[model samples]
Target: MTDLVVPAVINLDVPGPVISRHLYGHFAEHLGRCVYGGLYVGEDSDLPNAGGIRLDVVEALRALDVPNLRWPGGCFADEYHWMDGVGPRDRRPVMVNTHWGGVEESNHFGTHEFMALCELLGAEPYISGNVGSGTVREMSDWVEYLTRDGDSPMVRLRRANGREEPWRVKFWGLGNEAWGCGGHMRAEQYAAEARRFGTYCRDHGGNRLYRVAAGANGDDYAWTETLMKQLGDLGCAHRPAPFMQALSFHHYTVPGSWEDKGDATVFDTDDHYRTMVAAARVDELLTGHSNVMDCYDPGRNVGLVLDEWGTWWNVEPGTNPGFLYQQNTLRDALVAALHFDVFHRHADRLVMANIAQTVNVLQAVILTDPDTGALVLTPTYHVFEMNKGHQDAASLRVDLPAGLPSREVGRASLTTVSLSASRRDGRVLVSLSNLDAAEAVDVELDLRGGAVADVRARVLTAGRLQDHNTPAAPDVVAPRPHEVSATGSGLRVPLPAHSFVTVEGRLA
Candidate 1:
């Protein structure tokens, strides 16, 4: 018997909130190659593309069942002029990407291109309107141009631009980060802007817009408090999205200080441990923000959207620093799993959460070298793929003993084990993360409610803590069949250290 053990009981009968597939959402910014090269390889390029959008990238994101894609900008959204991206590709005006690398923006992947990209991936389009530097008219016109049908000015403009029917764009962001790169506005001030922008950015035709207000930064409870009190409050108890359907928050797990966010490929155990501890902080932030929301909107009608959350490591060596590019590793995969565990636990209030990026920037799932058409799925990609079953599944609480296991890193102690479960389509899905850097832990999982049979499992693990996939060796850290032993009352699942595992079986 191993000294390190996790005894968990998954209650099958008790039902919990259904996990939103949008919780597995993705973000694509105009930063770095994420747009120009990563997702778009140009119409004339030799790489396979549909209307200039990379087909390989679309296929890869499609494999993950990507729920929705937030586009056009991060900081760029505030400075982005939607008009500059429409019309003929060459005739479109260009601007400088001041937020990322000070590179010139061709405005090629604008409103029309993004809609096409989303269609190819079968994902919903979540556009962040320019609220910081852009006017309410611009945001409203863009909304009308995308969703309004028939012969209006915006509709005429849309038809002239080549797309005949209006695209149904529901999820709209009022802004990015109003306190920072977005606009440098206070919570109260931004709330006013959100209300005004959301008002004019109306539901055209039958397309009702789900406007998302730019929300608090990490743990900025006052910001959330202010937004709910000012924007979300309908002068009553929990009005259902009076002005804004959701509020957005951005949090990234930077392993170290912003000056040095730890290296992507090179890091000591202490660095790795700290990253895990920081990754787990999302739960605390979620709880804090949720608690504040409960105070203002008890009915939880105003959903919380974590529009930006992921690891923000130092840019890869020799790469453009402002691009926020970094490699994903086994540790990064573990970070994603920890966030998902928390996301499932708070499924009732949290509607959607998009990783900082989908490709080539920050913690991207798919990295592509556009010049060579080389694309590799990061370790984080595998975690998303393995747990796709949990999307829209009923959350099942994982009850574990108080004293499970722990590892100390400085003042904080990392819980070496974490797990979450959900059920859908008559099957139970379980995800377990063993954070111990050296020893694998055996989990004695007790299955309750009704009997489960034909238990199967797969794991994402690597030899080294920093093991990652590159184009040359893309399969270095991929999921493979994992062994599951049937126990008297449950199952014995061995979770390797610094790894993530998911098990599934039909409920009888």
Candidate 2:
């Protein structure tokens, strides 16, 4: 039997930084069906679409209150040329997506189409510039084309293409994965390249560009230290800096080695346990990277952007291996909940995080069937929808008792319960997850600095660890009302085994 932990206390009077709503952001790459079949069905398709984008997927994303979306590539962003994608679709050039699946890509969904989708979803567009295979002139001109309000060659080109009013794009990434697929450059080499490319990415009108530098991969502290040192030297010398606002890091939770990532839906108890342990490592990664940044940036000027993160597993059987299509299980939902708690605790230094490949890809929230026009909301989707209250809310410090009892999985051990709390509009919201796969634990909630008037809760759980939503049965794992009662001192709720729960209450 798993030990029942002591009550977790939340001090509402003490508030931390406001959690940036951008932290709940999503990513839509140009890979697989993420763009063509999942999000865009074309203007001539029989499926209901608004300007080539599927209406159902748009409505589902809107419900999550998605704050921002990163676009165009993981590796695709590096090889992509902006000019080939702009003009009339019929006249535009066609290219193969060399980095992802080697599939042919029509220049139909270019800058204009992406901006239109952002407008429809009411999300801020974050465009990743091509620094690996693109010239400085190309990147600079692309920014000028989208943001320049004045009369210029690029502005004329935009008018010729179609859009008259310039769409505002604030966030700009200098490159994606400069250390690997993005040119395989050394840390110092990439630093100089970033400065060169970022120099001409000028601000246009009201859009002040926030340039994000490509950062370390996983626990590569050497990479983090090298870039920080080089940038700091340039800043101290009074040289023009690269409008650098944030540094990005990519980390995915893989239960095993990259070559043999465990199956998404065929996992047993041990596989499930190991996955949770791996997801919990995000806290360590953030702390190690933040410490390195502090050495060069004592004031914490540069924010940490976890731009790509989620579980990566073997592709579903018979699916195109390069397409990276995998089913999201209950385990994926817990991983998301764990990440949310970690992000909230470090909201001061970490500003934004986007789950990798938002649709029809790794750990996707929404999956669709092209032939039947059927849509399935994965378990991970419910977790995001339930935890939407934490966006931009004031973080409340949570106090968990000692001996929380770490569970062992393979060679690693992790705490059984992960938690985060926040207060907003006289309401306190607490999110909790029980990592144990077999034993349900009773958690006591002690509220300080306030009295609870009423309480309500929602939980996501299933009969089996591998249970997931399929196109035929979409409601297998979804949010359901959970039992909550107000104790004399606070509230008490039972956290089911391998479950994620969110409890909200009015303050008295």
Candidate 3:
């Protein structure tokens, strides 16, 4: 029994800055086919590619309107050197990825290639700097090579490599997980290091750099406090200067055990409830981290970037665990929508977030079969596509009337339903989710002073909780279009249990 009611008209007039669709950002690392075969295939393959990147995948991401992409990492960003991946591909050096799949990383997909891929997808590129195993100059020079204009050493190198125009990359990360894969440094130490490395990142014309400093992992409040203090100190007359515009946080929902991580495609009601509970922590993490930041910067100049997030589970049997590739299920779709709603509600501080990986990796949107030349769209992909109407729009704080508890059976618990409303291009989109395993939600959406018509919905659900798509069965969990009508009381819809629905209405 889950119910939500509203007593007053909610004013959504204060549209925040269009949520950086980058918060809906995707990751691409040099692990497995994620680089070599998944995204970049070297221009010689017959896999329907453009300049070595998969055409179908690019088309899919473009349709979803993915705004930005994070490159060369998770853990790989810490050890990557920008110079090794530039210029001639064959002449480039190959380094062994110490953390992911322990596979050899060819310098084939370097800065130029990444920027090219971004052009194909029409998305912004957010390069993660190597602060863990790299020097201050390396970080600076990499920025110059990507953004600097003519006459600079890095710019000359860019021209020599066939790219005369500087790739206008705006978002950059100083480090990833400084406490773990990014070199085990204390918050204070990483904060100081971040100021130094970020100082030299030039803000080339039209490329306003959003330098992200290394931040906390999960609910680590001290890390945020310590880093904020250091940043404040550097900005004052006492130090080199604060160059960071944002701070990053990484959280993954790993049920059962962190090491074992369970499975990507197999799980029961208990596992589902526990996963939602764990996923709900993102809101807490963002709220707590924002509170700490407010203490340091009350005016809210610094933004919180949830850069690395998604579900992490054990690898499939016979699959390389470090590759981080797994099947995406309806469960993952709910997790994606849940996180998206949370980020939107906290849009003031939670500026950007990148899902773990884009392809052939954790929570990937597109999965390709090298053997069959087939591509499968994961359930997570449809959620992003359906929710595209919310990108870069103002959010309305929902006043959900007192509702029944979602459902609790043993250790399993559900939130019943969660809501987020946004307006884009004259359409009001209300995203509703029935998180319960067995109860469908009868919802009444009150639009207050506004009227809506030409209503419709795109429903994402399946017969089974663990249902997913395969190369052989690509349309398993696809969106089903349905007609809807707005009532005088509000919009009424029967949200199927364990399903996600996005109701769209043309403004009247």
Assess every candidate by TM-score: 0.98, 0.97, 0.95
lDDT for predicted candidate 3 compared with the true structure: 0.81
Best by TM-score: 1
lDDT of 1 by residue, 5-106 (tens): 789998898879999999999999999889888998889988899988989889989999999999886899999999999999989998999988899999
| lDDT tens readout by residue for model 3, 280-355 | 7788888999998887777678888988899888777777777777889999999998888888888877888998
Instruction: Give me the runs in candidate 1 sitting further than 4 Å from their true place.
Output: 232-236
Clashing pairs in 2: none
TM-score of 1: 0.98
Off by over 4 Å in 2: 1-3, 233-242
All candidates' lDDT scores?
Answer: 0.90, 0.88, 0.81
Candidates 2 and 3, the one with greater lDDT: 2
Q: How many backbone overlaps does candidate 3 show? A: 4
Q: Please provide, for model 2 over 226-304, each residue's C-alpha lDDT reduced to its tens digit, 9 standing for 90 to 100.
A: 7777556533333324557788899999988889999999878888888988999999999999888777776677788
